[model samples]
Target: MSPRNPMNARKQRIDDLAASSVVVDDAGTVDEAPGVSLIASAWRRLRRDPVFLLGAAITGLFILVAIIAPWIAPHDPDARLLIDQVSRQSNPIPGPQAGFPLGGDDRGRDLLSRLIVGSRQTLLVGVAATLLGLLGGLILGILAGAFGGAVDSFVMRAVDVMLSIPSLLLAVSIAALARQPSQWTVIIAIAVVQIPIFARLLRGSMLAQRSSDHVLAARALGVKRSAIIFRHMVPNSLGPVIVQSTLVLATSIIDAAALSFLGLGNPDDAKPEWGQMLGQAQQYIQDYPHLAIYPALCIVFVALGFTLMGESLREALDPKSRR
Candidate 1:
């Protein structure tokens, strides 16, 4: 046997694994280290990545706080425990005292408790909107990708029309036009704005995979057209879409907050959303900066966490990242 044959075999193996993740050991042997699907590989990468870890920590802590708010909050978020403190006389909005750390809002509610409880509303809105958009996008993207020509053209053109408008402006318009403003209005508006984005991304990804080897091989074999599409093409194409969903969660949160701030959020002040809290604090912002600062910081930090996780996931799932 020629020594070069072994080298050629090794080279062949390298080429085979090139499209996937490869690990080279000290012996110089190549192995498909993460012998798993794209999602499994991405999860492995996520576990080891500091950026993802930090983001996960922030995001997880937020979820935990939201879930346990009722148990951990020092006072009832809606109670006017400190209404006397803000009587517009001596102590106009008292600063942090015994029970009320971070002081009282103009409404005399415990600011700390409202901030804690508000996480539930924010998370609910963000998750709901993202899921809604993801569902709509999946349907449109599948139709366009699975059936090309007319369907593809029609869907793409419609998506193009949506893309032409600024996302925020579109959301604000939709939210503002609603007969009654509430969290559902914010959710619907945000979801509508997000649908086009997700649809376009999925369609592009599916199109790229349409001509790939696995798809062509399935066609060559006797796989049903629908089976080839859903079983192979759609699964393979979902990597980018999943990554985009994470990013959209952050965007949805921010969008929901924006609508809420613009008086388009839940009208029930008793619920105490972070965005509404921040909005209401504007008038008293001059004297009581903490009112605006706390909720604003919460929004920024949570958004940052999601954005970080999304970016890290994107990098992790990228085929180019395989080594």
Candidate 2:
């Protein structure tokens, strides 16, 4: 019909090709490929927040230091040198032996080396205590929130009793009662103090989530109570829990250090732990300032790292921030 008008002819040809094209069904769902893209997205969001980015970077550096301390430390953490025994007096000359890059403690042990090794113990105690607290809190919180009756009353009252007791006081009492507070003992003490806070936070979050529309829908669908609580409820409630856990980690580190400083932590001869190092350095603060300075700096940096990471996580997990 007049050569099918040139444009119409092209359109007809495209339609014919489309009609002949094969249709492949996509069975693959979005959930099937949760990959590095999610992490990349998270990193991008973190980059947008300068405070969060700085915190994450510092945290990552500390973790790397903890991992590689064995190789990176310049000298034996426990190595004691008596070559300059007479130079123990704080000399203003800053001798090679006396003023090490970070200087030596009164005992002649390398402060830098001890700081490096000490990170391991501090991180171990913090992470372990946080995990133990998390496990105890999760179960108690979930039960109280999901059931919401006698279980809730009992759990909340127990939490109240714990809250009434100051955390530091409780940790101190437990540490003293244990006779000798080993690493594990410190971990247990910290966890015990942390559990009440975790339980309360988790229970409150769970209670809030329990009344959400998705929860109501799951209930209406006749899903088993356990499944509703664990699968549907817990996952949704993890946002705040994760944020709180990070903060708790920082707190645990400080608590561990405090215990060690107070002689409620590692043995006197234990390999370089930050708290123990601080305790040792305190005696020589005026004579060898570097001894105290290095260890104290380590604590500050590690604590700052955890604090930043916690803030970032809190912001990321917040629903308002997401919007």
Candidate 3:
């Protein structure tokens, strides 16, 4: 009989340990458990997290409002309902009326209707940016992680350079460079800003997987490299990336609002957007700060929702959090 390779013996040992499964709890103690599925464990943890529940609720409500904006908005967002009450000098805006619970903006547009309807644009921009960014990152990250050496080094350097610039600054720069500043401009700029983040995240996760016992075992068993990467490594590396996407979704909304506020977003005042509304209110801010306050609050609460969910997801997915 041929003598066994020592490297093969080591791989087999590691493989056996991985198969038995090592579970770590918050106390930092590890225990052996067989047939433990990570997805099940993470889902169970998420179900019990109040933070995740709250985030989900807020996100769900935002989506609901966006979907039903047209039907639910009490007043026409584009109508100058209280124009008579608005005067740049004496009365910058109108106080809340019987129907207009939130009052009227400087332009005499119903603030409540604008707020309700604006959710659609916010949802569209945030979701579109996040999807595009995630797609771009997946392509770049996969190329770098699956093919190491020069490919990995080059990608990492670019990612590092992008990371050196603050996210909002990069987003602002990209948005400002647009020839025609619109919602699409906001979406694209935010997407571009997020690409390096997702790329670095995915690549780092994949790299960590390189030393995992399952990967080593797959190599020992002569599994095809492509299968080892896409089927095993990439899928496992997606947890953190998924969680990051939720957080990016929140950032995308804020960035969109900022771009609009800076006069780099949709130039049409007729279009109802939280950012645009906030920007228009700046001139009358001293006398009628409510215009800026409402939209700002909307942006803040919505962003907080996604952030909470993302943080909860991170905690739930961590191996140490398992019992």
Candidate 4:
């Protein structure tokens, strides 16, 4: 055998070094822990946050009350009580008694029972209106974001027009136009007012996503426009929308209550609705303050629950918050 060529010897030495450097793990599976997703990280942060925990607890309690109102309520929300018969009182406006813990309203309905059952209606209206607004806003946002130029201009301009009008005023107008003023009418009115807000937020988020590096990369890879827009763009930009949805739920509840207060909610007095209860309690407000106090407290605390959760979620999901 001739003396080995220098270049071949050098190549063999390099290969030997490269082979020696390789260190494969004995385990078949990957040993490193899996990377946590953004949502998982946000959830972890939320769980650790006291504010979020408090809000979640309150919200859960209210939801539980709403769900089991009928079973938990001591008296039928519609049932009227005559305190004069029970307590031999000359005064008509009744105060708290054995059966009625909170108090009695002007029409002698059990305030506690009404409140318990009203929670169901209030939550229903709030959730339904929010869903309606979210659905409409999502559609408008997707249309504007996916199809730029005329479509974007038109949708945005329409949104701006809606935003220009006072939300409460617009809701009142919409409700007034309806054949019958009912809970659904109130929901529609509130949802209509909310459409512009969600539309604008989602549109802005989507527009920002459209220019993001991932979206650009997807486009460069010849991905279908629909896939790029729907899968990559929409999903990534949904964080802000979801956070906003929580905030919007609080506003929606307030709007529903306002509508009910204005006599634009369910006209039927028998149906236990918080706003309707508040409306009925107005006359006896000075006489029996508890009537207003209890319902008002319920509304305030529920709204607070949503607000705290929404804000905490917003903070947790914010990119700047990441270490």
Candidate 5:
């Protein structure tokens, strides 16, 4: 029989709106609640992206291979089988023969097994190198972004210097300086080259977010500098960096292969790697091109998987792409 208070009416309307908003469950299912977050929406978009699905399928396959290579491989990667067939004692570089689906290498090692087992090394180096660069870049970027002035200038200058040089050349130089060209050496080399890319990306992200509303609110509320940085600024800046890491992983894999192809990879060919296998096959390309083709194809497919995933994520996360 009486009119309601305007404030109470407004509150009721707000509650109704909130109740009608869509929320994303842990499993990514949408339900009626508060509005979905940007990340949740991005994830939904990614699931719908054919490109992302394709990439995920290929990436998952490679990851599966990396994890189960040893158990699934029919022979040890280093096992020399029927050398006479390879060394021309009995036959000339046999092609896809019995017990060797992909044929044997110059050393009579089964190409199929080596390729299978090599997935572990390739994925390991790619992931490790990307993480190494991501860690270094995060440290430098946060340091420079949170504490500008001399620190920022110095860090940016160093990054610029590194950027000026060709990334592969820098990696090659680092590998050359190492005591020996091993898997670790190749990882470190590629990681060093990747550092500047991530550093610059993160630094720019941080700087852009420094003036954002959340950051200003945190500062106004007297939040500790570290809390504002780690909880507010850095967290907000990570989406692009995370996407960039996937792309960097693809590059890292290629860089590792390049180093190995240049004869700067693992010293021992006994433990076969995709790059090392390709390298050894080079001299015999004219006689047995299959040896090189398979490894090269593996590298290409793996890289394509990462690239597609990264690009799809980028598109999904980009606000403009929603249109």
Candidate 6:
């Protein structure tokens, strides 16, 4: 064969390389790169783990129900019906005429509506408390871990003290001190109770990441300490923090519900809260079992969703767990 031109040979080589390379067309931008597609790769890995898939599905369902509660709930959560009142008073049998698919509360509110609304309240409290705790903990924990000395000792000792106190008792005391326990009060109480947990987890994570080569190199490059700690160190150490935060959310919700059940939460007349409903249902337990059964199931299902999701996330994110 005749010798090929240098340019032709180069063109053929380039075409062959292009044929083997991965091409990603995102919107109008064409990217020819050799990297795993995020969705496909994630789906493949998740499909290999049945437990993780189940957890993800449950978590997603709970989130969907929470977001669409108002539209999906059959009765107006605030609406009161005469049938509901009679049903609550008469120890009536469970049926559609009772104005409740589940049953009515002592106040004649629809149990299902209340449960739907309660999901929103529980999720709100859990997320708000977790975020607040995570923010405060990450800052203090990273500061303590990255700069180990008197600061570390002082912060950890404080954490130890907080950890020693029973979280429920501390929340109760705080709630009692507050003249009126509003939603914000409950959130704050939960956040305060959870701070030590997040702080301890984040502190340990930061301590581990601080010795990593990237962190050492960043320090060697004379990056500002604040930037190194917050921008670099915190981000790198967030895997465990994210997993812990998820678990904390489940615990916070349960704790908040417990506080409400104990009458240390939003006022008694508030629309619907799982804990409050559970507390109210106690009076009518024998008469209308569904009233309590439904809300208890809600709490169980939601708590289970969060627990499963947290476990899945922990396994996915933690190197130790992966092995």
Candidate 4 clashing pairs, residues 3+ apart or interchain:
none
lDDT of 3 by residue, 254-296 (tens): 9989988998888976768898888888987887788899999
Report the Cα lDDT for candidate 2.
0.80
Give the per-residue lDDT digits (tens) of candidate 6, residues 145-166: 8899999999999999988999
Instruction: TM-score for candidate 3, please give it.
Output: 0.85
Off by over 4 Å in 3: 1-36, 220-222, 321-323
Per-residue lDDT of 134-178 in model 2, one digit per residue for the tens? Answer: 999898888888899999999999999988999988998888888
> Of models 1 and 4, which has the larger lDDT?
1
lDDT of 1 at 65: 95
* Each prediction's number of clashing residue pairs: 0, 0, 0, 0, 0, 0
The better-scoring model by lDDT among 1 and 2 is 1
Candidate 4, 1-323: lDDT as tens digits: 99889999999999998889666675477559889998898999989899999999999999999999999999887877744443435555677778777767666778788899999999999999999999999999889888889999999999999999988899999999998899899999999988888888888898999899999999899999999988998988788888999999998998889889999999997878888878877976886677788889999999999999999999998988643
Candidate 5: 10-residue stretch with minimal lDDT: 86-95
- Ten-residue stretch with the least lDDT total in model 4: 82-91
Q: Rate the local accuracy (lDDT) of all candidates.
A: 0.90, 0.80, 0.90, 0.88, 0.89, 0.78
lDDT of 5 by residue, 232-254 (tens): 89999999999999899999999
TM of each candidate vs. truth? 0.87, 0.81, 0.85, 0.86, 0.88, 0.82
RMSD of 6: 9.7
Which candidate ranks first by TM-score, i.e. highest? 5
**Model 2 RMSD vs true structure:** 8.4
Model 1 vs. true fold: TM: 0.87
Q: Indicate the worst ten consecutive residues by lDDT in candidate 6.
A: 87-96
RMSD of 4: 6.1
